[model samples]
Target chain A: MTTSPQNSADSRLPLVIEKNLDRILDTWISELQVDGGRLLNLIRESELREQASRFLDLLRKAIKVAGVNPEKTAAYDELRDLLDELSRSRSEQGFTPTETATFVFSLKRPLFRELKEAHGDNDTTALLDDIWQATMLLDRLGLNTTEVFINTREAIIQRQQQDLLELSTPVVSLWNGILALPVIGTLDSERTQTVMESLLQKIVATGSDIAIIDITGVPAVDTLVAQHLLKTVTAARLMGAECIISGIRPQIAQTIVHLGVELGNVTTKGTLADAFALALKKKRQKVQDI
Target chain B: MYRIPILRVEEFLLVSIQTDLDDALAVKLQDDLTTAIATHHARGVIIDISGLEIVDSFIGRMLADISTMARIQDCHAIVVGMQPAVAITLVELGLSLSGVQTALHIDQGMRFLRRFLAGRDEEASDERE
Candidate 1:
């Protein structure tokens, strides 16, 4: 049987979706935050820049096949241009500015392994020094351990800052095209977006009826995190996923309770374990009812 | 990083932490100090904070917790290296740490611990008689 040209193109549609996922991630990092290097710097090394471009090409193709975006393809392109322009003048030194751009982009594989296995003194002082110094430099904060903690909160905030270009979500997973996300750390407007896209994609792909998120890792429940989390659950529901929340830390739980914001018919649990358990139970109940 | 203003010489353990005590690191400090103090029966603990610009509630609470925990184990905790702003912020956070000693410099905290240890040794000697 001969396959029509259109049918062949349609077969490659998954490939296109995979390419779009990379585009989405790139745009999200470039536009979502303002502080630190998130693809906002250039590798002054000509060879490395060439390498980055090839990497980008590979990523775009893979993302497109994943059915990566909803309405973000054009925006992703625009953000890439903006980031490319920003990095065009930067030197390739300073821990590979391109690799440090975002956790996903710069440290996806072998390079990350290189960082992990780099040798140091076989002592606690050396190991702690390495981790603390690296963390501080990456977050652009002061180095003080075992005493002053002024920089930790600042560093966390810097990591969580939101720009319009990136999603508000930090963690996204797709199982059989159903997206489930759990966002830890502080949520800014930008991360909230990444979360939404992940959830929506899962809804579309898996026809998912449930998404459970555990917020126990969040340091504090600021208005932005609360609002963003609320928005994501609502959006998921619209796409036909029942979003469940688990792992609300005591401090954050107090803050949310104090804020007196009604959670608008969303489910809550003590932890991600509980949330998933609830999801399984609900799914089972549905089967029984049927 | 705050410049080390106080260096303490102690008979058993030297406790000097030269960083701002934020919640995340404070947790680390709390763990480290508890171990160091126990292992050494550290008569002196010096915390330097001159490098800090701000101190939030979490860190403050952790400091208080560390101080109490150390004292319970018969180890004294001393706080040093506080910047002006950091000191002020902790005060405003409604956190008042009792029994946790603070000095303007690490040297002073050391001297206090040294003196306290000396006094304790003297009492032990007399009690042996």
Candidate 2:
């Protein structure tokens, strides 16, 4: 490997890439160290440097989308020099071409993003050697983590417009247009909006006098959850229906108070049975008033 | 900080708002909720703000639209869980609900809705006959 290192480096085409790789590694270390890692210490500890490299690559690449200005080039250059020095150390930490290639491959995404933002489609061809390897590895790894990230971001926006879409619950109208909607699962901003809208719409469509929301399936409740619940109850009332909140879990109950969120005088029941009783109590009181 | 909806009820959609309800997400919420309610005929919609640190103008506008739309569908809108900061911001910002009714808690709002439901029932029976 040592005998062919010079030839290998020379033959890799596009002299600038070797320089860039040299720059990226050398700069990343000294500048992006965590817990006060020194350049020399990082070089000595192969595992530590490897870990450091991974973290920096992940964050830098993602953040590169924000735009990598030339002003920060100094930091990258400094770190790359440190790594370059380590690569040439007397202890023989010389990276084979494949290893160097792997390091470059890991950086493919951030590079692509940065290049795209800077020069449009032009950057794609410049890093073909590196990008192709990364792409193949990415395909093989098939990480679905990005999907979750996408869904999460999308869900946030979806909450504002529709509180609810009525995708799961079945709304049935009774003799006096009573509607019972049982909600299960988690609620977020997007889902909260969906619930609010769905409830309001169902109230009008079914003309239901009462809507019971059974929360037996709710896993947890925080400030966001509490807010969504409050919105839902409020919306139900606007539609002219009595809203019943059932199933307050022990942990959730603790969290609500810990967070100091007022349920807005909303009736809370321990179980669905209790919720029905409360709804019935309202009916009885109405009869008495009449 | 993305908040996803797990359950939706009539006029009472349950969603946990999280992360920052940034410009892009706020727009999505407004449009999607508008579509869902328009199709479902939801009268009242509750917006839970437990997971959010703040509510921007975009969120405020979407709420207003949702309330107005609910009215067209014969449903009233009630904004719930307006954090004290949020309330102050909305008031200081000179933003008020024109077509929406708001309550501090869900229970108070529910009582008001019960009456609407009762009144509508009598009217609905009359219409059916």
Candidate 3:
């Protein structure tokens, strides 16, 4: 199978890829196993072999149909789809972006070796041209894998954040006519809305006259946090529930004064215990000293 | 055509809004409540809105207006049993109903009225003395 450069110049590339397809796949798998990264543990050996074989076959077909520039052609659509699915699943399976990207990058060595073996040493110019084209195609595909992987990871992170927002703002009834809302984590506008909604709902459900908003779990208090707290307090008051803001740490007190954010007529206490005591007082219920 | 029933309980007038009110009914309720406050010589008014789930700006303003009308007639108005969603809507609409006093339930509203009237009675007796 020795043909002149003119006979097999532009079209010989795809044929060469098809001819050494098996050797390239074998070399790629052996290299992945030898590298022995966390990819091996996250994915089973059989599964990895299946994906690797499918990827190589699709890639060879795409190159044959689309010539050296597979990425620009519609023929590579299936190949892109396969890679996108692989990256998304890898993200779901807890594989890092590096590992996902490495799956495509690892194909480079076997392909370069195949191109070298397909051409003789005298045809250095042809060998270089083939190597450059292969490099460009693989780089594009590798980048695509990374882009999809990052998107999947971002979606996962967003979902978890929403769940965390719901979980952190829970309102519990402390007594017959009193409710307590313990807020943890930073208070953003979105989270403040959740806090207000849950707190107000509990107040109405329990018919609680007094609400103690405990923020001991909140790490810091800025002007924005102060504003959020005030908004929640005002909403509760409008529902006929007097709001008592508790968990005012010493630092928070200083911060409040420094920010010049007035809490107005809303009552504030140093601790939840003190706030509960005040709520009872306002309810005209006396706690007999034991 | 639906008239919100205003029940007189001792020194306090009790009004429970159980259904969605149209513009005409809401205005009628205000007139009826104010008339009841005067006719019954009530010292306090308690409006139970627990059944009222949606309080648009129109309804919120009506509530505030009722409270103010009752107050001008020498009666303290307490809006009780306001749902969480209603309160949020009121606040978002920028109608705080600042003139109206609030309580969590009818019983609490009664207690608040009793305390308030008792304080007023003491002041009256002192003035008489």
Candidate 4:
């Protein structure tokens, strides 16, 4: 059974990795520690070694089954999964993209050394061929690690935005029948929808008839923000609750007027105190001085 | 023909919609409610719709029409117990029901109608003076 030079070179790389797994992992980890010193501090030494060995084992198996194109084969799925987990954990631990990817690319030097040792001095062409193949596979895996890291970071940002949206809109019951929703941030359409739904839900739960939307924490009131405020008010009114927008800074009021935004019949107050007082008045309750 | 029941409570006629209303049933409800208000000489009408989970644009229009019809007959209409989701949908559909009054529940609706009517009576007396 005679194998072509290409087949022999492709098949021999995996054999070299399997034979020198320990030596490769030792060199890879040391290379990573030198380039990714900050990343190493974030994770334990033993855990790092285990991850490196597992990755090398999977890579060898993948190469044996799928040759050079491990990415297009089911044999590489376990390798990809391991990379995904490593990238996610490293990203969460504050590893930079370069640092995360170095975990895979750093394996190149150790692997090329082992491939050279296996090929010896007489087969320089086979040695170069093996080195090129190893380079291509490692580069693909390195890029995949960076991509996973970026995606994980983006997912975290999206979840934080959702949490911030929920946190900013809080509907508190001020009196027996008055609810106060202090609008602290900029009101975009999505935030306004959350605000509207939450305020209306609180109205039903508390049976509050009046809601004061205090925008004192809002930095600026643009036309779009005013429109969002109106939508929220309209939604609240539809649910049988009146909205009193308060905390309107003088500048915001000026901006609203200059923008020709029609707040029209939705009540506005200069301060949260004034709005709360008005809400109490509408409910026919007076706060008397002792 | 199915009819949405209208209950008369003192000076107000209470219409609690417990089922999803189609076009014909909605129109029949409008007709029945207007007739009920005139015959009972009710001062206000309270429409409770908490049981309704979905409302299309047609039903929104019908609600506005019902309030307008009640107003023509010298009666005030307060829509009560609207679900939060329905209210959001209505506003999103650009049907804020501005002409129609709304309350969180039936009891609040009754209180609003009483206060509203009392205010109107005082204004009428003031005008007479």
- The TM-scores that each candidate's chain B achieves against the reference are 0.76, 0.73, 0.95, 0.96
Error of 2 at B69 (Å): 26
What TM-score would every model get versus the actual structure?
Answer: 0.31, 0.32, 0.72, 0.89
Compose the digit string of candidate 1's lDDT tens values, residues B15-107.
Answer: 455555556566666666677677766665655554555678887777668778877887776665444345435544555454466654556
Highest DockQ against the true fold, candidate? 4
Off by over 4 Å in 4: A1-10, B1-3, B38-42, B117-129
TM-score of chain A of each: 0.42, 0.40, 0.77, 0.90
Q: Which candidate should be chosen as best, given lDDT against the real structure?
A: 4
Q: Which ranking of candidates, highest lDDT first?
A: 4, 3, 2, 1
CA lDDT, every prediction? 0.52, 0.54, 0.85, 0.89
* Predicted structure with the largest TM-score when compared to the true one: 4
Worst 10 residues of 2 chain B by lDDT: B83-92
Residue range A47-166, candidate 4, lDDT tens digits:
889999999999888888778776568989999999999999989988899999999988988889898889889888778877877888889999999999999999999999999998
lDDT by residue for model 2 over A1-290, one digit each (tens)? Answer: 12222222322222223235445555444433432223344345566467546535543442243222212445344444433433333113333333322333344444444334443455444345334433543332222223323444455557643344455444544335445666666877666655566666666555455677777777888887887677666545433356777788888889889999988678778887676666666666433443
Q: List the candidate 2 regions with Cα displacement exceeding 4 Å.
A: A1-169, A172-176, A284-290, B1-129
lDDT for A33 in candidate 2 is 41
**Fnat of each prediction?**
0.00, 0.00, 0.81, 0.96
Winner on TM-score (1 vs 3): 3
